[model samples]
Target: MIAHGSLILVLLFTSPLMEAFSQPTKVVTLVMFKWEIKEEARLLERRMLYLHETLDVR
Candidate 1:
């Protein structure tokens, strides 16, 4: 009974170590893309021009 209990304790402690060694390493990559805001700026300028034209067209 003592041997059986010792074996069980040994197996339980070793299982987690075996699992860590058996798994492959994982690589994680974070990618970010920067987009130019020129188009948005042009759109805002056009809106401002339209507002100016409406106010000045009278």
Candidate 2:
């Protein structure tokens, strides 16, 4: 019973540290997603410009 209680205490103390470690992973994922979106937007813009130029030439 005592061991179980101690284990619970350990978990309680460590949970916040675990959460803190995970927070940065979430931020990194968000930043990476944002960059991916920006890159995709740039690619789309380039494609649109190419299409516009092709249409104008025709």
lDDT on C-alpha atoms for all candidate structures: 0.69, 0.95
Clashing pairs in 1: none
Tens-digit lDDT track of model 2 for 1-58: 5698899999998999899999999999999999999999999999999999889963
Q: Could you tell me the lDDT of residue 5 within candidate 2? A: 87
- Each model's TM-score, in the order given? 0.35, 0.68
Model 2: lDDT equals 0.95
Which 10 successive residues of model 1 have the least lDDT summed? 26-35
Best of the candidates, lDDT = 2
lDDT of 1 by residue, 1-58 (tens): 4698899999998998787666533211111111236666788999999999989955
